[model samples]
Structures are given as C-alpha cells and as structure tokens.
Target chain A: DAGITQSPRYKITETGRQVTLMCHQTWSHSYMFWYRQDLGHGLRLIYYSAAADITDKGEVPDGYVVSRSKTENFPLTLESATRSQTSVYFCASSESLWSSGSPLHFGNGTRLTVT
Target chain B: GIQVEQSPPDLILQEGANSTLRCNFSDSVNNLQWFHQNPWGQLINLFYIPSGTKQNGRLSATTVATERYSLLYISSSQTTDSGVYFCAGALYNQGGKLIFGQGTELSVKP
Candidate 1:
C-alpha cells in the first residue's frame, strides 16, 4: 500500500506489561507522529519524529516511548501499560512540518486496552 | 499550550440538509486542517486550509487565520457523512505538532 498502516488493529494487554505498536508508511514522509485518542480529549500527541533518527515529545509523552530507526517505520512503545493508557492510537505522517499545503494522513488506528 | 475549542459538540441532521461546524483556537496558527473520523475510526483529511477557502465535492472549509477560527461546511448531507469532525491547528514554532479540538459529532439520518 502507498499509505500509512498500523499493526495489531486492536490490542489488549495487562497493566505493567510492555506493548509495542507499529506504524509503517510507504510515502516516506519526513514527519511521523503518534497520537492517543480518548473521550473528552480528541487526540493528544505522544511523540513525533522529524527524520530517521530525530524524535521529540508532544503534549502527552509520559510513559510512552517512540523510536524511528528508518524513515518509513515509527513505532510507539508503552514501557508499563496502565488502565489510563488504554485508548485508541493513531499514526500520522506529513511531508512538511508546518506547511499550509501539507496535511497529515492518518492510519486506521490501533485500539489498545489495558486491564 | 494553545486552546482549541469546537462548537455544537453533537449534531443530528436529515439527509440533504446542510450544516456548519466551527473551530476556535486561542493563538495564531501556521497550519489548520479539517479531518473526518469515520465510524471505523479512520481519520480522513477533509481540508488543509490554513487560510482562504477550498472545496471538494460537497464539503468546503474556510480558515481565517487572523480571526483564529475555522469553519467547515457540509452541504447536502448524506448518511455516509455521519462521523466525528475534528480541527487541528499548529502554532508557528511548535515543530509542526498540532493541537486538536474536542470535535463535532454529526449523525445524518436518512
């Protein structure tokens, strides 16, 4: 596929366990982001990668780790999953950082539940 | 952090009716985008209007950067339009990270 794809469409893990969500994009976009969606909060950014090895934290980066070893792959890891961390996760990519014409393309999303 | 608020959190419209959703941001933004999250939880890009106006099919969006707000207009609504509409804005020096509003949930009944 030419667009972004997220793995394990749905996941359920126990608290204190580690879980990794994978995101892959074929467009080779320079910017990749991970967001978690909750009821009142629309989408809160967990982490983002500017390039292959450059990454930064977003609004909500606590307890979540992200790494981008390659331009096409950006994975989000939860070192210790908690019930509060159970939410739908979305992976997005863009060509430019803050350009007007560059809009984000989101994946189908991964629904994670921590019990 | 900038605040992003959306109006009319929930809306129900009949097919063929028209509706408008509004998004307000607390600060100036360099990027503004409208997205439609379908029932399957897929976020589809609706418009990438930082300023000015753009139309695609029966959907159109207008963003007035100076006013710090954006409007998404959905015309001739269809059942397929039922979903959550979100607007995200990025500040000038935020490294392209966007802050999203709560979103407007629309249900189109046929």
Candidate 2:
C-alpha cells in the first residue's frame, strides 16, 4: 500500500486468452512504465504513461495494451496471450522524469506463463 | 533511438574483490540509470547518474554524457552482491522512456 504493488504474482493463461495485470502506486507519481523481461533480450519496455489518460507505446507493444485512467493505477492487458508473451513483467513509477532526483521505483514483478 | 551496450557480458569474482561494469550508449543521452536485479528477481535502482559522479556506500557511478558511457564501481563485493547489473539511457524530457543495455551478470563467490 505504501509503494508500487503488482497483482497476481504468478499467472498461467492459455493461448488466445486475455489477461490483465494490475499495478498501483500510492505515491501518485506522474510517470509509469511496464516492461517484460526475457532471458536473452533482457528487459524491453511495453508501454509507458506520462500522466492520467496519456499513454504511449514502447519498443515491443504489438500485442499489449495499457491504460492509465488514474494517476495511481496503470494496468497492462494482453489482448490475446501467446506463448512468446510469457515472461516476467515489472511495473515502475517516478515522481518526475527519470533522473537522480526522481528515479523510477519498481514493483516486485509478476511472472506470467502462457501455454 | 539510442542503443545501450554493456561490456564483459559475464564476470566471476571472489568475495572481497572489486569490479567495474561498463555501459556504452550509441548516441547522446540526457538521463542514465543503473539497476541491480538480485538472485530473487527483484529489480532495484542503484543510481540515476545522468552526467556526473554519485556514490552510495561501496557503490559509485559515473556517467560521461559527452562520451556516451557510464561506469559502475563496486568495492569489496560480497557474496550477496552477486546479481545482474543493467544500465539504461534516455533522452531529456523524453517522457521517462529508457533504452536498457543487455546487462552484466556478476557472480561473486565466497
């Protein structure tokens, strides 16, 4: 409740199904991000939100969707889960732009598996 | 788009040893950050050194924006320090987006 929190610590879904991961930050930061971590590629950003209702796609955002209806919550939805989409997801937030004064704070991360 | 590259893809060290990890960015960056992913898969921000030197305990970081590179120094590393270190770069006011390097996998043996 104090810092960033991610729901469904571990999840398993079937292909072609939809899954949603939730992220909530009590700090009410202005910036939020969603990233997926794979073995060889390290971590690639999925999407990021500047503020409430303002969202943009990141490097790998083809099958993912993100919505930030409120400043404290940013949720990522997988329209149709695929096997390649199974990876660890991390949610982060920051007060200002990413810098020493306002660095991004990360969540515990969610491990998702698609079968 | 900026590209981040890390050197010495893997490193092994004994306890109490010192190590330096390097990150090279392809282009100019206004913001740079270092993160440590522990054995438990927890990602923690070590520093946000955009263009200068900053230190915290045995950990210190330096970023040369002109050279498009950053260095992370760990002194007297412990077994608990074994983990993956990553450096990311981003443009100024780019809405909090970062291009992350592949990361350095450090293993400190006791």
Candidate 3:
C-alpha cells in the first residue's frame, strides 16, 4: 500500500516488559514521528526522526526509544512498559519540512495497554 | 515550541445543525493542519491551511496567521461528523514537527 502502516493494531503487555511498535510508510517521507494520546493530555509527541540516522525528543520522550534505520520505517521501543504508558500510539510522516505544502499523514494507530 | 489551544472541549448537536471549532496558537507557525479522529481511531486530514481559507464538502477551514488562530466550520452536521477534531501546528523554526491541541469532541445525534 502507498500509506503508512502500524503493526499490532492493539497490544497488551505486562508492566516492566519490553514492547516495540512498528511503523512503515511507503511514501518514503523524510520526517517521521511518534505520538501517544491519553485522556486530558491529548496527543503528546514522544520522538521524531528527520532521516534514517537523525532523531530528536519531543514533549514526552521518557522511557521510550526510537530508531529509524530506513527511510520507510520507524520503530518505537518501550524499555520497561509501565501502567502509565498505557495509551494509543500514533505514527505519522511528512515529506521534508513544513514549508512545501506537505501535510502530515498518520497511521490507524496502535492501542497499547500495560497492566 | 508552539502551544496550540482549542475551544469548546465538547459539543452536542442534532443532525443538520452547524457548528464552528476554534484553535489558537501561541506564536507564529509555518504549518497548520486540521484532522478528525474517527470513532475507529483513524486520523483523517481535513485541511492544511497555513493561512487563508479552504473548503472540502461540508467542511471548511480558515487560518489567520497574523492573528495566530484558525477556525473549522462544519455545516449540516451528520452522524458521521461525530468525532474529535484536532488542530496542530509547527513553530516557525521547528520545521514539520507538529504540536497538537487537546481537540474538540463533537457528538451528532440523529
């Protein structure tokens, strides 16, 4: 498909266990981002990558790690999932920066529950 | 960093009613976008109005960059329009990284 895809549409893991969320995009967009949504707080960015090897932290990056080894894929890892980390995770991508009229696109999102 | 704020945290409307949602940004931005998170949790892009106005079907949006705010209008609302509407923007120097607002939840009753 020519759109972004997220694996394990829904996931349930125990606290202290490690879980990885996978995201793949067919558009080869240069910028990829991971955001987690929760009640009251809304969607908070966790990490973003400008390229395969360039990544930066966003509003909420604690306890989470992200790596982009390929332009088409960006994965997020929770080293030790906590109950507080239970939320819906969204993966998004855009071509280049905001300047060229390229709007962001998001996958269906992954619902992660830590118990 | 840019801060985005949305008004009318929740709304309830009868089918065929029209309503408007507002978004305010803390500073100037290079990008502004509107999205609707469907009941199924899919984020669908509604508009990419950095400034000016744009319309699609029964939805329309207008961004007044100079004033640092945007507005989304939904006309003749239907049951399908019930969802969370979000507005996000990237700070001028921030490139494409978007900061999203808390969103306005809409419920349309037939």
Candidate 4:
C-alpha cells in the first residue's frame, strides 16, 4: 500500500509482557505520531517524532515508548504492559505543521488487550 | 493544552436525512480538520478547514477560527455514513499535535 500501515491489527498479552506496535508510512513524512483511543478520552497522543532520532512525549506517555530511527518507520513499545494500557492504537503521519497539501493521515489502528 | 468539545455525542438518523455536527475549541488554532472513523476502524480525513467553508460530495464543513468553532454538515445521509465523526484542532505553535474532540457517533438506518 502507498499509505501508512500498522502491524498486529489485534493483540492479546499478559499484564507483565512487553508489546511493540509497528507503524510504517510510505510518504516519508517528517512527522509521525502514536495515539491511544479510549472510550471517554478520545484520541490522546502518547509520543511523536519530528524526524529521525528526534522524539517527544505527548499528553499520555507513561507506559509507552516510541522511536523514529527511520523516517519511514515509527514503532511504539510498552515496557511492561498494564491492564490500563489496553486500547486501540493509531499511527499517523504528516509532512509538516499546517503545511499545504500535507494533511495528517492515520492507520486503521491496532486493538490491544492487556490481561 | 487546548480543549475541544463536540455536541450531541450521539446521533441517529434515517437514510436521506440531513444532519449538522458542531465542534468548539477553547483556544486559537492554526488548523482544524474533520475525520470519519468507519466501523472498520479506519480514520478517513474529510476536510481540512481552518477557516472558511469547504465541500466534498455530500459532506461540507465550515470553520470560523475567530469564533473558535466549526461545523460539519452531512446531506442526504446513507447507511454507509454510519461512523464516528471527529473534529480536531491544531494549536498555533504546538508542532502539529492534534487535539481531538470526544467525537459524535452517528448511526444511519435504512
């Protein structure tokens, strides 16, 4: 596909297990983001990468970690998954901040369950 | 941090009916976007209206940035349009992180 893709469309893991969600974008966009969607909170950003080797925390970054070693890929890892970490994860990409013809695009999302 | 609120958290409509969705923001924004999350969990971008009005097919969106509000209109709704509609706002200097509203879940019946 020519757009963003997420691996492990659905996952089930134990509370102490480690899980990694993979995100890849073909556009080589400069910005990539990881967000978790919960029932009442909507989509909250967990981490974002502006470029290769640069990353920052968003609203909720407690149990999540993200790295953008390559512009085409941004993967999120859970150090030790907790039951509260269960949610649908979405990956997004964009060329720049409010740039012309560079709207944000999102993946289909990965449903993760921490038991 | 910006606060985004959407009205009528849930909506039910019959096919061929029309509907309007509203979004309000707490602060100034550089950009506003409307998205539709289909039942399959795909977030499809509907419009990127920071200010002014835009239309695409049976969907149209208008954003009055100065007023810190935006509206999305769905005309002649179809069952295929059943999904969660979200409106997100990008802060003026926030590095493009989008603050999304809780969303309005729409259910269309045939």
Listed in order, each prediction's TM-score against the native is 0.97, 0.97, 0.96, 0.96
Each prediction's Cα lDDT score?
Answer: 0.92, 0.91, 0.92, 0.91
Compute the lDDT of residue A81 as modeled in candidate 3: 99
Error of 3 at A71 (Å): 0.3
DockQ of each: 0.73, 0.72, 0.66, 0.66
For candidate 3, the chain B TM-score comes to: 0.97
- The CAPRI classification for model 1 reads as medium
Shift of residue B78 alpha carbon in model 1, Å: 0.9
Give the per-residue lDDT digits (tens) of candidate 4, residues A9-43: 99999999999999999998998989999988888
True contacts kept of each: 0.77, 0.64, 0.68, 0.61
- By summed lDDT, the worst window of 10 consecutive residues in model 3 chain B runs over B89-98
Put down candidate 2 lDDT per residue, B37-81, tens digits, no spaces: 999999999998888899999999999888889999999999998
Error of model 4, residue A6, in angstroms? 0.7
Poorest 10 consecutive residues of model 2 chain A by lDDT? Answer: A96-105
For candidate 1, write residues B1-110 as lDDT tens digits. Answer: 68899988999999999999999999978888999999988899898888899999999999999999999999999999999999998876877577889999999999
Q: Give RMSD to native, each candidate.
A: 1.1, 1.0, 1.2, 1.1
**Error at A9, model 4, angstroms:** 1.3
Which residue pairs does candidate 2 place in steric collision?
none
* Candidates' chain A TM-scores: 0.97, 0.97, 0.97, 0.98
